[model samples]
Structures are given as C-alpha cells and as structure tokens.
Target chain A: MKITIIGSGNAATVLAKLCVQQGHSIVQIISRNEEKGKNLAQNFNAQYIPLNGTVNKNIEIVLVAITDSVFPKALDGLNFGSIPVFHTGGAVSMNVLRNTTTNYGVLYPLQSLSAEVEEIPTIPFLIEANSENSFKILNEFANTLSNNVTKVLEFKRLRLHAAAAIANNFTNYLYTCAKTYCDNEELDFNLLKPLILETANRIQNNDPEKVQTGPAKRQDVYTLGKHLQLFSEYPKLRTLYTRMTESIMHG
Target chain B: MKITIIGSGNAATVLAKLCVQQGHSIVQIISRNEEKGKNLAQNFNAQYIPLNGTVNKNIEIVLVAITDSVFPKALDGLNFGSIPVFHTGGAVSMNVLRNTTTNYGVLYPLQSLSAEVEEIPTIPFLIEANSENSFKILNEFANTLSNNVTKVLEFKRLRLHAAAAIANNFTNYLYTCAKTYCDNEELDFNLLKPLILETANRIQNNDPEKVQTGPAKRQDVYTLGKHLQLFSEYPKLRTLYTRMTESIMHG
Candidate 1:
C-alpha cells in the first residue's frame, strides 16, 4: 500500500515506521511543522508537504494522526482524491471524517506510544469504518501493522475510551498518589514495585474482581480506619481512599 | 534455624516453603484447624499442634501469620521463652507483638502470595523489629528468603501499608471497573490488556506523575465531559471518574 501520513507526532511517526517495516510505502509526509515533516520524509524517501499542500493522488491511503482539537479542519483544503482516510484519535467519531473522503474511519492504536522507544511494543489497533468495503480495507491494513487488532465502532468507542481512561489513566493516578504518600512519609517507593508488578501480572490470567484483596474487600474495618487516619493531613488523599474503599466494599 | 509457624493459611504456607528452601527446619505447624495444620506438618515431617497447644521449648523462633482480629487474645498464656518471634502482616505495628513476647517484630512480604503457585515470585520482605539485635536477626533471615528486604520502622509501616493498598487493591478495583464497563457495553475486555500492561511497564522506569497522560492530565475538557456523560447512569463510577479527573487536573 502506498500510504501518506499527515501529522508528525508520536503516533504518526510510530505508525509510519510500522507501515514501512511491513512493506508498505509512505509516499508523502504532511505536517504544519516543516522541520519534523522534512526529517520524517527524509527517512522514508517520501515527499514532504505542508499542511495546506496538495496530497498525492497516487497514494493508496491517508493516515490522519493529528490533534483532536484541530482535526477535520486540519485535513482541510487538501485533496486525496477518494483514497481511504483514517484518523488515529480514539475519542473522535468516524463521522467526523465523513466530508474528507468516500472511505474514511478510525485507525487508532490502543496503547500509549513513544516514538523514542527502541523497540515499539505491539499496539492493539482499534479500527472502525463507515462501510463494509472500507472496513475490510482498514481491517486488513491494521492486521498487517499489528497482531492485536479489533473493530470498535463509533457507538462503543467513547465508552471503551472512558474505560481505557480508568484502566490506564486512573490506575496510574493511583500509583502517583501512592508514590507521593511514600515520598512524604519517608518510605522507599521502591518497596511497592513488586506488589505493583504482581497486581498487573495477576490480572492477565484472573478477573480483577476475583483476585481482589485488601481491607475494604475483606471488610477489615480496623485496618481501613487506620489507613484513613494516616491520610488525615492530606484531605484529598483521605477522601480518595475513603471513596475507593467504599467502591470496593459495595462492588 | 528451627521454626514453628502458628498458621496454616496462604502466607504461612509460602513462608514455611521459603524457610525450608533456605535450609531452616520447620519444627512444628500450629493452628486452630487441626486438619490443615496436620496436613501442612505432614509435608515437613513436623509436629502438628492445636492453637492452644504447648509451644515446643526447643524451637529457635516462632512465626505468627494469624488474622488481625484474633491476635493478642489468641496468644494469651502461650509461652515462647523469649525466642525471636515475628508476625507477617503489613498494616500491623511491631509494637503489637510487644505484649506477646520480649523479642518480637514484623516479618512481612510486601507482595501478595498464593500457595498454589508452582514458583513463587520474589517478594520484597519488610522487616521491623523492637530492638537493634532483633532487627539484625530478622533482617538476616529475611535476606535469605528474598533479595529485596527493607528495614521499615513502626512510624512508617502504617503509611506504607496504606500506599500498598492503593497500589494493589485500588488499582485492581480500577481494572475491575474497566472490565465491567467493557462487559456491559458488549466490548471485549481483552483489547485493553496491552494498554494495561504498558501503563504498568511505563511506571517502572518513569515517575507516574511524569508519565501521566490522558484527558484528565491534558485538561481535555471535551473528552472528560464525554467520559463523565457516558458514565452518568453508573453513579458510583461517574463520581469516581469525576474525583479522579479532578485529582489529575489539580495534581
């Protein structure tokens, strides 16, 4: 496939690399930033085009990996001439690309990615399309890029996005809270590393509900009170501790 | 060292295995449940004693892995003759064992353990002792069992315990919430596995606060509001989403 990637960011760079490594040609690199655009294009031996420049009609597909705020409009004034277009944002709806081309949908990788990583880990790409033909094209292309590809439509995208936020963002926030507490209490945050790793490992094979273990789950009110008291000085943490404990108890 | 363990639970079983692996002798297995106690003792060719039975005077040390509820009273009138005693619990203070014996402290593994696992992962042992001599003895034994051992005092144990609960229990709850959301929405929870694993892997080398990304951290109000709206029907999850979003926003 002859691909054109618009946006020179982390997701864009990584996806472009994947496409090239999988025997696909990146025909052009389009971006608002000239330096990054040229540098990325230089690596691919592809044409470097400004955001408002003409997109090659010869390209088989277009990958839109820009910011959500400037999306839809960012792909403006450029012509891909009925070539398939795919946006890499998770939150945006597929209909947002309705005006861009005849065949357009979402081609988002469902993992936090960094371009600087020496070896990019396998990312589960969530592909959604407008029609059956477009779905087939996008799904086939996605499978070439990743082994873990799933079709998530617009209806379930936001809900799944929110759940991903809880699983990744909220849990990382909990870790941040715990690390802050350890720092303040003069405890080594390193001590909790093994427990953190085990929690992640255990969930791989077991349901989180079944493997749940703690004071709140066991209704150890004494330990729960003691934990709450320790966080009294930090009211925000105290409330979070209380609310989460209640959530688990009721769960 | 000749050891006598006063429990037949998961922690007790794992700890006994560790002691035996390190060439220590399990002099006896003591528990209120005779069947489990005798069964555990049979594995080591050691005596099985009732919870109220006499402590073997020749045993070098006694390990207490009992529940917090029945503690202190459970040890009432039992005599250990000042041989170093250790309790394996996180939320407990070293002072809790002060009433039971003259030389007693904590010998807790920071990671959650299950006896059924064929190979136990390395657990970071957190040791707290009443005296310098006791600390040395406990730390030495802990070193033989685990490569990761730390000297956490009573002042910091409770705070560390709360942090561990947040790192393990609260994070696992978040995973459960995400999985439940996926199940209700008719989405495959397996798709989020790589994302979950990446979040855990990212935190190993980077600070959680530093690597924090998502709508909450980015102040992407549009996506945050969309997430909250999707979670509105589930009030508890909605509130949790709001609280966590606020936490990341203000963090």
Candidate 2:
C-alpha cells in the first residue's frame, strides 16, 4: 500500500517508520517545516513536500498527524482527490475531513507518543470512518500496524478520550506534583517507585477499589488533618488532596 | 532468625511466607481473630496464639502488622520484654511504640499487599529504629527477605509515604474512577488497558512532565467543557474533572 504522511511530528515520524518497516510504501512526507519533512522523508526514501505545495494524489492513504489546533487549517488546504485521509487525533472527529474528501477517517493511536524515545507498538489504535467502506479501509490499515485495533464511534471515542485523560494524563500530573513536593523538601522520590509499580500491577488482577489503601481511605482523620495542614502552602494541591480523599472515601 | 508475627493481615501473611521461604523459623503467628491466626500459623508450621494469650518472649523479632487504629491498644497488651518489636507502618514514627517497649523499630514494606495474591519478592523495605543496635538488627532482618532495603528517618519516610499515595494509591483511585465511569456508560474498559500499561511503563524511562498529553495538557477547553457537561449527572466526578483540569492547566 502506498501511503503519504501529513505533518512531521512524533506521531507522523513514528507512523512513517512503522509503515515502512511493515513493507508499506511511504510515497511522500509533508510538513510545514522543511527540516522535519526532510528528516522523516529521508528515513523512508519518500518525497518531502512543503505545506504550500499540493499533495500527491497517487498515494493510497494520507495520514494527517498535525496538532489538533492546526488540523482544521491543514484540512482546508489539503487536496487529496478521492484518496482517503485520516487524522491521528483522540479528540477530533472523522467529520473534520468531510469537506476535504469523501473517504475520510480517524486513526487515533491511544498512547502518549514521543519522538526522542523508542515507540511501543503494542498500543491500541482507535479507528473511525464516515462510511462502511472507509471504515474497512482504515481498519485494515490500522490492523497491519497493530493487533489491537477497535472501531469506536464518535461518542464512545469521546468517552474514551475523557477516561484517558483521567487515567493517564491526570495521573501523570499527580506524579509530577508529588515529585515537586519531594524536591522542594529535599527528599528522595526513588523510594516511591516500588509502590508505584506494585499499584499499577495490582489492577491487572484485581479492581482498584478492592486494593485501595491510604490515610484517606482508612479515614484516619488525625493524619488527614496533619497532611492537610502541611498542604497549606500548596493550596491547589491541598484542594485536590481533600477532594480526591473525600471522593475515594464516599465512592 | 526467630520471628513472631503479631498480626494475620496481608502484610503479616506476606512477611511470614517470605520468611518461611528464606528458611527462617517463625516462632508464632498471633492474631486478634483465632481462625485467622490459626490459618496463617499453619502456612508457616508455627504456633498460633490468640490476642488474650501471652506471646513467647524467646522470639528475637516481633512484627506488628495490625491497623493503625488498633496499634495503641494492641501494643498496650503485648509484652515484648527484652525482644525487639517493630511495626510495619510508613507514616507512624518509631516513637509510637516508645512507651510500649524500650527496644522498638520499624520495618515498612513500601508495597500494597494482599493476602490472596502471591507476594513479589523484590519489594523495598524502609527500616527505622530508635537506637543503633535496633537499626542493625532490622537491617539484617530486612536483608534476608528483600534486596532493596533502606534505613529512612521518620520525616523522610513520611514524605515517601505521601509520594507513594500519589503514585500508587491515588493512581489506583484514578483507575477505579475511570473503570466506574466506563462501566456505568456500558463501555468496554478493556480497551483502555493498553493505554494504562503504556502510561506506567513510560514513566520508567522518562520524566512524566515531558510525556504528558490529553485535553488539559493540550489546553483543549472545548473538549474539556464537553466532558464536564457530560459528567453533570455525576457531581463528584464533575468536580474532580474540573479540579484536576484546573490544576494541570495552572500548575
């Protein structure tokens, strides 16, 4: 299958490399920045196109991997003829490309990706299309890259996007907050790593509710009050701590 | 080493199994509940003693793995004599046992334990003692069960405990919240498993801040507002959604 990648971000570069490794032909790589476009295109021996130039219609699939804010603007200028175009966005809908082409879909890789790090290929892909034929094409395309692929509708995908925020994004923020607190107090954060790993592994076999343990969960009000007093300096953290504890206790 | 476990909870069971596996002699397994004490004692081929009975003073080490609320009451009744007793608690200081016995210490396993689940041997134990001799003994004892053992002070251990809450307990709560939301909505929570596992694995290799994503990090107010609106039925969840998003955006 001949593929043309749009954008040169982490997702675009990763997808390009994976597609090439899977024996799919990457005909072209497009990016607003010449250096980024050249970098990815050179890796796959594909043509590099600037944003101002027209897209090559010979490519079977066009994957737009640009930032969500720029997705609309990028689609406004894209002319892929009748070729199917898919955007790798969790929040954005498949209908965003409705005016651009008849065959449009979504190819959302449900993992936080980074260009500097090696990609983990086992992450699931959430795919959606405007029509059954387009869904089939996009599904096949994703199936070639990953064994874990789901054809989720827009509403369910939105719910998943929200859940992902709570589970992944918000959880990581909590870790960052903890690290910040430790660093400020000149403490070692490494001691918490074992507990972190164990907590994550527990959910593989048991519900988190059954495994919950902490001062708040135990309703140790004295210790909770002490922790709350310590959080006076970090009002936002204090609020979060209080609210989360209350939720866990009552839920 | 001659050991006497003072409780028959998850921590007690895990520590007893590990000690028995290491070929150490468990002198007795004591519990407030006679049945639980007998069951745990049978596993290690040790004697089972009810709380009303006296503990044998010949034991070198006595580990109290009871709940925080019962620690004071339990310690008041136990006779440590010249035996070194340690409580397996992260937040509680060694001073909690100061009035109960002259020889007291702490041996906290920084992992969430479950009686039904098989224990992982590679857990980190935070050891503390009121005196140098007690510290040495606790260190030597922890060495037999786990390779990752550190002598931590009360303040540092408290910080570590708080950090563990963020990384382990709090993270698990997030997973629970997400699972509940998915279940209530009739969505397949299994689809999020890959995302959850990858999120945990990513922190092993990189700083969480650098790999952060989702609506809050991306500042996608539109999608966030939609989510909050969707969560209107769940007041607690809606509040959590708003608070977490605000923290991430502002912090």
Candidate 3:
C-alpha cells in the first residue's frame, strides 16, 4: 500500500514509522514546518510536501494526522482524487472531511504514542468511513498494522475517547499531584512506582473495581481524614482528594 | 532474627512470608480467628496464638501488622520484654506503641500486597524507631528482607501515604469510573488496558507532567465539551469529569 501522511507531529511520526515497518510504501509526507517534514519524509523514504502542496496521485491512502482543531485547515484544498483519506483523531467526526474529499474515513488509534518507545505496543484502531467500501478498506488496512481493529461509529468513538481520557490522561494528572505532594514533603516519588505498576497490571486480569484497595475502598475514615489533612496546604489537591475519596466510598 | 507477627491479614501474611524467605524465624502468629492464625503459623513453622494468648519470650522483633484502628488494641496489655515492637503502617506514628513497650519502631512497607501475587514485588520499607538502638535493630532486620529500606520520620511517612492514596487508590477509582462508562456505552474496556500500562511505564522514566496527553492536556475545548456532554446522563461521573478536566487544564 502506498500512503501519504499529512502532518509531522507525534501521531504522524508514529503512524509513518509503523506503516513503513508493515511493508507499506510512504509516497508523501506533508507539514507546515519544512524541517520536521523533510526529516520525517527522509526517515520513510517519501517525498516531503508543504501544507498546501499537491499530494502524489498514485498514493492509495492519505492519512491526515494533525490535531483535531487544525485538521480542517491542513486538508482544506488538498484533492486526493478517488483515494481513501483518513484522519487519525479520537473525537473528530468523519463528517469533518465531507467538504474536503468524498472518500474520507477515520483511522483513530486508541493508544498514547511516544517517540521514545522502541516497540509499538498493541494499538486498537477505531475506524469509521463514509461508505461501506471505504469501511472495509480501512479495516483491511488497519489489520495490516494491528490485529485489534474495530469499526466504531462517531458517537461511540467519542465515548471511548472520553473513557480513554479519564483512564490515561486524568490518571497521569493524579500522578502529577502525587509527585507534587511527594516533592513538597521531601519524599521520594519513586516509592510509589511499584504500587502504580501493580495497580495497572492487576486490572489486566481482574476488574479494577474488584481489585481496588485503599483507605477509601476499605472505608478507613481515620486514614482518609489524615490524608485530607496532609493535603491542606494545596487547595486543589485537597479538593481532588476529598471528592475522589467520597466518589470511591459512596459514589 | 526471631519474629512474632500479630495479624493474619494481607500485610501480615506478606511480611511473614518474606521474613521466612529471608531465613528469619517466625516465632508466633496471633489472630482472633484460629483457622487463619493456625494456617499462617503453619506456613512459617511458627506457633499459633490467640489474640489474648502469650507470645514467645525469645522473639526479638514483634511486627504489629494489623489495620491502623486495631493496631493499638492488638498491642494493649501485651509485653514484649524489651523486644522491639514495630507496627507496619504509613500514616501511623511511632508514638502509638510508646506505652506498650520501651523499644518501638515502624516497619511500613509502602506497597499494596495481595494474596494472589505469588512473588513479592519490590516493596519500599519506611522505617522509624523511638531510639537509636531500636532504629539500628529495625534497620538490620529490614535489610534482611529488602534493599529499598529507608529511615523515614512520622510526618514524612504520613505525607507519603497521602501521595500513595492518589497515585494508587484514586487512580484505581478513575479506572473504575472509566470502566463503568465503557460498560454503559457497550464498549470494550480492554481497549484501554494498553494505554494504561504504557502511561504507567512512561512515567517510570519520564516526569508525568511532561508526558500527559489528552483533550484537556491539549486544551481542546471542543473535544472536552463533547466528552462532558457524553457524561450528562451520569451525574457523578459528569461532575468528576468536568472538575478533573478543569483541574488538568488550569491547575
């Protein structure tokens, strides 16, 4: 499969590398930044094109891998002929591409991608398309890179993105709060690493609610009070601590 | 070293087994329930004693490995005859055992332990003692089990516990909330597991604040609003979602 990836961000970089590794040909790499675009194109042996430049006519797949808000502008004037164009976004609907191309779809990968990770972990591709034929083609293309591919509609994909935000993004915020408290108290945040990893690992084989442990889960009021008191100096953390504890115990 | 464990709970079981693995003798296992006490005692080749029964006089270390509330009652009216009594609690202070024995310390292992885990993960032991002699003795005994032992004071331990509550407990609750949302939407929660594991693994080497990714972290107001609109039917999750999103974006 010959593909053209639009954008030179994290998502573009990850998808470009993975697609190349899966025996796919990268025909074009487009970005507003010339340096990043040239670098990514060089890595995949593809032609580097500026944002408004024309894409390769022979490319089978065109992937718009920019942020959700910047997505429309990035593909505003690009014409991919009859080729299937897909945007990699969790919350952006497939209709966003209606004006740009008739053969548009969504190829959202439901995993946080990082440049530093040497191996690409199992990425669940949540796909959507403008038509049945486009859907089948996107599914087949997704299967080439990952075994975990599913056709998810826009509304359901939005909900899944919400859940992912809570599970991944918000959880990392809590980690930041934990690290902040540790720094303030002159404690080593590394001490909490084992517990964090174990908690994540346990949920892989068991339900998270059933495996939950802590003062709130066990309803240890004294310890909860102590924890709240410990966060008295940081109002934001204290509020989060109290509300999350209440949610766990009573919600 | 001769040790007497004063409970049959998860912490007590893990500590007793780890101590036995380190070639230390478990002199006695005391609990209100005879079956559990006897079972744990048999596993370590130690005597099973009732809660009110006398412990072995030759025991050098007495580990009061019970819940924080029951800790004081377990040590009340019991004499260790100059043996160092240590309570394995994070928020608990060393002064709790001041009246029970002349030699008292804390052996708080800062990790969540479970019966299902066959091998003990790396557990950080936070140690505190009332005197220099007790501190050295407790340090020596802790060294036998783990190399990640540190002499932590009471206030620091309490704060560490609070941080841990967020990093582990509150994080797990977020997962529960995410799972609940996924179940309600007829989506497979398994799709989020790889992201969860990757987020935790990334933070092991990088600071969490730098690696945060989501709609809120990216300050995508449209996507954030869409996520909040999805949770409107579930009031508790809606509130948590709004507040946590705001906290992440602003706080």
Candidate 4:
C-alpha cells in the first residue's frame, strides 16, 4: 500500500518506520512542519507535501497521526475522497474520520512511542473500520506491522485507551515516585531494578491482585508506620501511599 | 553450610529451595505448625523440630523467616547463642536479631515470593550484618543464591524495602485497578498486556520521567476529562486517577 503519512511526530515516525520496514511504500510525507516532514520523507525519498497541499493521488492510504485535540478538524479542509484513511489517536473516535472519506477508521498503535527511542518496541494495533471490507484491508495492513492486532469496536477502543493510561502511564509514575524517593534517601535506585522486573514478570502469568505482597496487604501496622514516618517531607507520595494502602487493605 | 530454616511460609519455602539447590545441608526445620514444617523438611529428610526445640548444634546458621510482628518474641525461648542468625523480614531491623545471637544480620530478598509460583525469578538480596566477618559470610552465602547481591546499610535497607513496596506493590495495585476496570467495561484485559510490558521495559533503559508520555504529562485536558468521566462510578479509581494526573502535571 502506498501511504501518505501526515504529521511529523513520534507516532508518525514510528508507524512510518514500521510501514517502510514491512515493504510498504511511503508515497509522501504530509505535514505543515516542513523541516520535520522533509527529514522524515528523506528516509524513503518520498515527496514532502504541506498540510494544505493536495495529498498524492497514487497513495492508497493517508495516516494522520496527530494529537486528540486537533482531531476531526485536523482533516477538515483537506480532501481524502474514497481513499482509506486511518488516524492514530487512542482517545479519538472513529466517527471523527467519517466526514473525511467513505473508507476510514482508526489504527491506534497501543504503546508509548518516541522519536528518539533507538529501537521501537512491539506495537499492538487496535483497529476499527467503517466497513467489513475496509476492516479486512486495515487488518491485513496492521498484520504486516504487528502480530498483535485486534479489530476493536469504538466504545471498546475507548475503554482500552483508558486502561492503557492506567496500566502504563500511572504505573510509570509510580516507578518515578519510587526512584525519586530512593535518590532523596541516598539509596541506590539500581537495587530496585530486580524487584521491579520480577514484579512486572509475575503479572504476565498471574493476576496482579493474586501476586500482591506488601505491608499494606498483610496489614503490618508497624512497618507501615515506619514507611509513613519516612514520608513527612514527601507530601504527594505520602498521600498516594496512604490511598493505595487503604485501597489494598480494605478492598 | 548446615542451616536451620525457621517458619513454614512463602519466604521459608523459597529460601529453602534455593539453599537445597545450592547444595547446602538443612540441619532442621523448626516451626509451630508441625505439619507444614514436616512437609518442607521431607524434601531434605531433615528433622522437623518444634519451635521450642533446640537448634541443631552442627548448624552454622539459622534463617528465621517469620512475620515482622512476631519477630524478637518469636524466638524468645529458643536458644541459638553463638550461631549466625539471619532473618528474612525486610522491615525488621538487624537490631531485632541482636538478642538471639551474637552474630546476626538481615538477608532481605527484594522480590515478592509465593509457594505456588512454578518458576522463581531472579532475586536481588540486600544484606546487612553486625560485623565484618558476618558481612563476608552473608555476602558469600547470598552469592550462591543470586548473582545480584548488595551490602546495604540498615537505614538504606529499610528505604530499599519501602521503595520496593512502591515500585512493585503499588505498581501491581495499579495493574489490578486497570484489570477490574476492564472486566467491568467488558474489555479484554489481555489487550492491555503489550502496553504494560512496554511500560515496564522502557524503565529498564530510561528514567520513568524521561520516557513518560500520557495525557497528564502532555496536559491534554480533553482526554484527562474523558478518563475521569469514565471513572465517576469508581470513586477509588477516580481519586487515584486525579491524584496521579495532578502529580504528573505539576511535578
């Protein structure tokens, strides 16, 4: 499939890489950011088109990977016609693409992507299409990029996106919190790596609730008091700690 | 080394297995629960002694893997005056073992353990001892069990344990929270696994703050509002969501 990747951001960069890697031709890179657009297009020697410019006629698909706030209006003035279009915002609705073209859907790659990451991780694509034929096309395309692709409904995709935030973003914040605490206490944060890895590994096979072990879970009052006493200066962590503890204990 | 394992619980089972795998001879298994003690002892054909029974004279070390609340008093009547005594409670102080034996320390394995887990993962042991000789002995013994071993001071060990609780225990709770939300929303929890694994893997090479990407970090008010709106019925999740969002945004 010939793709015109719109927007020169992390998602665009990663998806374009995967697309090119799978032997899909990137016909054009379309973006208002001329420098980034041209830089990304240089990799495939593809034409660089401005956002308002006419999308390449030969392109089979236009991937608009932009922020959630800019959706619907992001493709408002531009015309895609009957060409299949896929946007990659997790929170954005597939209906947002309805007005753009007769064949449009979402191809949300469910992972935290970054332009600077040397090696892109495996991406699980959540796909939704306007029709069964479009779904088949998108599903085949996504399969070229990743083995873990699922045809998700609109509402279910929204739920998955929210759950991804909780599982990935919130959990990373917890790691950051722990790292910060270790740094402040002059303890080596590196020591926590094995434990962190093990914790992550345990969840692969068992429910997190089943593997939970801590002072809070067992209601160890003395240890909890000691841990809490160390958090007098870290008011934010203290609050989060107390809330998590109570939730685990009483739940 | 000839060793006596005290208690017949998760930690006891795991450490005993590691000891046996490393070719150490079990002098005895002592616990108030005779059935569990005997069951564990049968693997090595070691004697199962009552809690009040004497520690085997030939045993070089006694591993008292008991609850923090039962510590100090748990071995009140038992005598192991000259032998090296090591306990496995993370929060319990090295000082707690001082009265039972002249040579005492802590061997805090910084990972969650369970009797049911089929394959025990790599463990990092944080050790502390009363004297230089005991430190050397404990370090050498720990090296037999795990490749990653560190001699952490008492205060730092406590801090490490607290940090482990944050990174592992708190993180696991977040996973459980997402899973529950997915279950109630009729979304497949397995779909979130890739995101979760990627989130965990990212922290291995980069700082969690550096790799942090989410609505809260980016200050996307629309998506945050949508996520919070979804959590309205879940008061606990809503509270955690808001707290985490604010923490990421402000700090």
Chain B TM-score for candidate 1: 0.86
Two-way lDDT contest, 1 vs 2, winner? 1
| Residue-pair clash count for candidate 3 | 0
Q: Please, what are the lDDT tens digits per residue for candidate 4 over residues A116-220?
A: 677788898999999987788888888999999998887888878888898999899999999999888888888888677777777888888887888898898
Please provide, for model 1 over A1-251, each residue's C-alpha lDDT reduced to its tens digit, 9 standing for 90 to 100.
Answer: 99989988777888888999999999999999999999999999999999777667888899998766666788667655578889988889887777778898899888876565546666988889989888999999999999988887777877778898999999999999999988888888988888888888778878888878778987989889888888989999998999899999986
Q: Which candidate number maximizes TM-score?
A: 4
Q: Which residue pairs collide, candidate 2?
A: none
lDDT for each residue of candidate 2 in A1-251, tens digit (9 for 90 to 100): 99998899878987877787788999998888899899889988999989888667887898999877666877666777678989998778788898778899999887766675686546689998988988989999899999989888888887887888888888888878877888887777666666666776677777777878777788887666767777788777788788888888788
User: Model 3: residues >4 Å from true position, as ranges?
Assistant: A33-39, A42-45, A71-73, A99-102, A116-119, B33-39, B42-46, B116-119
Per-residue alpha-carbon lDDT of candidate 4 for residues B120-186, written as tens digits (9 for 90 to 100): 7788898999998888888889899999988888778887888888998888998999999998989
DockQ of each: 0.68, 0.64, 0.69, 0.77
Q: What value of lDDT does candidate 4 attain over all alpha carbons?
A: 0.86
Worst 10 residues of 4 chain A by lDDT: A69-78
Candidate 2, superposed: residue stretches over 4 Å from native: A33-38, A42-44, B99-101, B119-121
Q: True contacts preserved, each candidate?
A: 0.74, 0.59, 0.74, 0.74
Estimated TM-score for each candidate: 0.90, 0.93, 0.92, 0.95
* Cα TM-score of candidate 1: 0.90
Residue-level lDDT tens digits of model 3 in A175-226:
9989987877788999989888887887887788877878898799989888
What's the residue-level lDDT of B87 in candidate 1? 92
lDDT of 1 at B74: 67
Instruction: Report the number of clashing residue pairs per model.
Output: 0, 0, 0, 0
- lDDT: worst 10-residue window of model 2 chain A: A114-123
